[model samples]
Target: MKLEHRIGQLLLIGLPGPQLDLMTRSMLQTIQPGGILLNTHNIEDAQQLVELTATIRSLIEVPPIIAVDQEGGRVDRLKEIYSPMPSADLFRASGDAAVAARMGEIASEALRTLGFNVNFAPVLDIASDDGANNGLKGRYLGSNLAEVVRLAGAYLEGLQHGGVVGVGKHFPGLGDCALHRVVQQDQCSLECGDRRARALPGLRRSLAAPLVAVQEHSHGIIA
Candidate 1:
């Protein structure tokens, strides 16, 4: 690949509508980005979603990665057409690894049917019970590191089995910080480092397990 094309592969961009407009088509043809991440604005229903993704894919020579934040609960993108999924906390409460795994399987099936290849899910953040102010309260697996690893591992397994790739998120951790607001970069780094230090052992163990497959995406870097 040319250097320009190689650089384009690093971008995973989003469009503003359910269908590709002239500008989106032009951009895709020019850059040929490696992936596209869709949100609620780009999805109307399952059929529309399938068509939109198909159109986007047809524009590029290489198969592009189609991704969505289908983590269920408050972050789900398919809630309008699909059944609402329970929060991550609910699975942790059940204390059954299979529950998380089943949720992943169901989510993957829905996403794959809609032409999506990736699901940003199985939040590994260990949210506090009173984490509403921190923005990660109900989205987390649990505050217990062991439980988070167990549930997240199973969830990853289910996603892979269902033909969708799962991307574990908000690393090194976001349980204590509210990402909606701004903070000094230095302070942010310190907090993230602390959280990682506390969670590192469990993270290592989880990654070493056969079922875990995670990729990090930083959503709050100011640069």
Candidate 2:
């Protein structure tokens, strides 16, 4: 693929199903997006998922990467009948890397079974002092950077072992920010040298993993 086409492939797009047929046709005919992301609103059931993916693939000259936010825990989108997963913090609370690995394996397997190739998950944010860092209340793996990195790495490894790609998110750290980071008004702990170093470990792990891509959260560079 040319650089232009390769760059095109990096784009992930969301489209409504009712209009998917037309929109996909247009994207293929025009934009030729590299991938399509399915949201809860676009999914109905197993058959629907298969049908939607098939239709979208048919439109594109190359098969587009299929993705979804199937993180177990609070951010799950595929919750029609699947078993609910505990949040990352809950996994860390278990204090067992094995348990976290198992959960990641299960999450990857479920998404693989559902025909999703990429899963946006393993939120590797640090959430210490829950009262002060309310934003990391649930999505966090742990407050300690070293432990968080270890646990998150285990989870990503498990997911990869299950043939599913894992993506790390909300870069530069958002654990200390108040809830809804973009709207929040608090100085992030990342400003602290040690805290900033903590956040990078998980990202480094993801960079080493054979992931599809890291979902860049909409936060401008702090400095």
Candidate 3:
């Protein structure tokens, strides 16, 4: 591959709409990106999603990674096809790792059937404050570090067991961040240092899904 195409393979981008139309096809052919992360905008219903993903594959020789943020709560992209999934807190509230695993299994089954290979899931951030508007309120899986690790591990295990890759998200623990508010880059280490210990076990549990990120996108991650 050329250097330009090699660089293009590093990107994982979002589409503006559901279908892979002429413009989308052109973009995919040109970029040949490493992956495409599908959001609600890129998914309408099951049948449309299948056709769209199939078209994406047909556009390129090597299949591009297809991903979705189907972590339940506010981020369930497949909610239109599958029933609305409960937020992560509900599983924590249940205090049973099995419940979380079951949910992950069911989710992976659906995502795999819909032509997705990656499920950005099992938010590992600790739920510290309910009042804080960091965009991770309902998305957090545990009230503390241990709960996060155990339940998140169970969930990811289920996701992988069904053959869909599970990407444990927001590494170094993005528990409290605000949207569009850029902080000093130098301070990132200081901020993330405390959470690194907590994040490792979850990483070990879901090692199958390689963790990766880009620019700050949503307030759901930033405080």
Tens-place lDDT digits, model 2, residues 1-223: 6566667776788886623665567766466678888888887887777777777777766677788876667777878747677778777788788887888799887887767777888776666566764444677787776777778878887888898888876565666565446656444443642565555754585433544445544543342
**Prediction 1 global C-alpha lDDT:** 0.77
Is 2 or 3 the stronger prediction by TM-score? 3
Better of 2 and 3 by lDDT: 3
lDDT of 3 at 197: 50
lDDT of 3 by residue, 43-124 (tens): 8888999998888777755678898888888887888898998889899889898898898899989988999988878787
Error of 1 at 162 (Å): 0.9
Quick one: best lDDT, which candidate?
A: 1
Which ten residues in a row are the worst by lDDT in model 3? 214-223
RMSD of each: 3.1, 3.5, 4.0
**Candidate closer to the true structure by TM-score (higher is better), 1 or 3:** 1
Clashing residue pairs in all predictions, respectively, total: 0, 0, 4
Pairs in clash, predicted candidate 1: none
For 118-197, candidate 1 gives per-residue lDDT tens digits of 88787877764444455566788877777788888888888878988887766666665544444632123465657655
Order of the predicted models by lDDT, top scorer first: 1, 3, 2
Residue 17 shift from truth in candidate 2, angstroms: 3.6
Order of models, best TM-score first: 1, 3, 2
